[model samples]
Target: MIYLDNAATTWPKPNQVTEAVAKSMKYYGANPGRSGHKMAIRTSEKVYECRELVADFFGLSNPANVVFTQNSTMALNFAIHGILKAGDHAICTVMDHNSVLRPLFAKSPDVDVSYLGADSEGVIDPSELEALIRPNTRLVAMTHVSNVCGTVTPVEDIAKVCRQHGILFLLDASQSAGIIDIDMQQMKIDLLAAPGHKALYGPMGTGLLCINTDFELAPIMQGGTGSYSKELTQPLELPDRLESGTLNLPGICGLAEGIRYINRIGIANIREHEAKLTAYLLDGLSRIKDINIIGKKNTLGRTGVVSFTHNSKDCVDISSYLSSNFSIATRSMYHCAYKAHEALGTSDGGTVRVSLGVFNTLSEIKILLYALKNMM
Candidate 1:
């Protein structure tokens, strides 16, 4: 099968990732940090190694600042709920996934929110953000890339505005974490969240939240953090402050191996390969008379995700045909960004999403194009 839905969750993860996860489950089944036994210590060390690797990959100064969660949604929830309080205002863009939008809306009824608009191509303007910023704006949460449209937001420019106003900047790097370069120090990002199942090539149930030491967020979950067993209150340290209960050691072990693989292969090389494949798909889809490609015409300002719609075919039908008849997997829907679809004028029916991964090749894209043409 030719899988093209890497944006949702990567498939055929790197062999190292699978091997590492299996090894952890089979060899070290002990709960990390719960005991001082050899097995427990070894498990704890592996988890810390994963944390350090994630910190290095994201250019974070300290590994302790990184907190592991179940997925990006959980990390986002922690950042949103922990940072904002009643009567505070936050700014976000329409291109954000529901993971970011829902929590902000669920804030105290007294809290205020501003949903900034994006262009037809799903690009958010820095000036638009500047105009929306208010004195009461405590945080500005936005995504690095639109999962539906594949449009890369101007994060650095937005970060500049947030820095100038002294507002907390929260970046949802769900789409761009492993593929794009993100520097926490340079971007002035106070909180960053991402899922390991996507570009990181890790197993599911692994996510990360990096909090800047200067900013303190309340703990969303409180329990025995292993550090403050005697105290009723949770520890106020970097990781133990947020990470409660036993972490997913097996998933984190795979995550560490995945980061190492990315480091060895180089992120730039992976970016180049995906960009070329996206460009090739765009060129091929553009040739079909009845097809309409979405987002930026070129792959310069986008990740490996490509979205398009055909004149006569329904989006769901196309995806079904691809999966059943052609054995080519694709995603068709709002992509969890209903507002983004409205902004891009695809509210009638969401576009077909073809997301390439590091393992994807030109040959797979060519086969997908041929399949699309045959369907047309």
Candidate 2:
């Protein structure tokens, strides 16, 4: 089957990722850091190894600042809810997923949320963010990349604005984590969240939230962190403060290998390949008589994800046609990013999304184009 829904989750994870997870479960699946046994110690080491890799990959100076979570949604929730509180104000863009939007929405009337608008191309001006900063503004939540439109937000510039305003910067790097170059320290990002399953090519049920040491937020959940066990209250440590319960040791083991794989291949090479594929997709889709590409009409400053809708055609019908007839897999409907669809006027049924992965070849693009053409 042709898989084009990688924006949802990457398929066919790297061999190293699978091997590492299996090895962890087989050799040292004991509850990490919960016991002094050799197996538990080994599990603890393996989990820490992943933390170190994630810290290094994102340019975090310390691994302790990284906390493990179930997925980007959980990480995002921790950041948005942990930081914004009563009488405080936060800012986010319309392009953000419900992960950011819903949490902030719950805080409405108490914690003010000012939304910055994105254009038809799904680009938000960095300067506009400064205007949204109110005196009570405590944080600026931004998506590193738009999941629906694949529009890359200008985070560095936005970070600069947040810095100038003394507001904490929260970045949802769900779509660009392993695929994009992000220096958390250099970018002045206060809280960064991402899923290891997507571009990282790790197994599902793994995510990371890297918090800058200088920044502090209350724990969202309370439970055992395998540290300060004798104490009744949760530890006020960097990771233990946020991460409660047992770590996903096997998943973290695989995630470490996934980061290693990305490093070995180099992000630049991976991005270049995706760029070519995105360009091909855009140009070809443009030529189709009844097709209308979403967001930027070109590949400039976007990820490999391309969302398009047929003129006067329902996206679900198109997706079903492709899947049943050509064995193609595409994401239809809101893509879990309603604000982006509402901004682009695709809110009814949204657009058919094709997200290319590192393993996707030019031939796959040709087949997808052929299938799309036949739909008309």
For lDDT, the strongest prediction is 1
Against the true structure, what is every candidate's RMSD? 0.9, 0.9
List ranges where model 2 is wrong by over 4 Å.
Answer: none
Q: What is the C-alpha local distance difference test score of each model?
A: 0.90, 0.90
The residue-by-residue lDDT of candidate 2 on 241-285, one tens digit each, is: 988888888889999999999999999999999999999989999
| Residue 147 error, candidate 2, Å | 0.6
True-structure Cα RMSD, model 2 = 0.9
Per-residue CA lDDT of candidate 1, range 137-225, in tens? Answer: 99999999999878999798898889999999999999998899888888778889999999998999999999874778899899877
Single out the weakest 10-residue window by summed lDDT for candidate 2: 211-220
List the candidate 1 regions with Cα displacement exceeding 4 Å. none
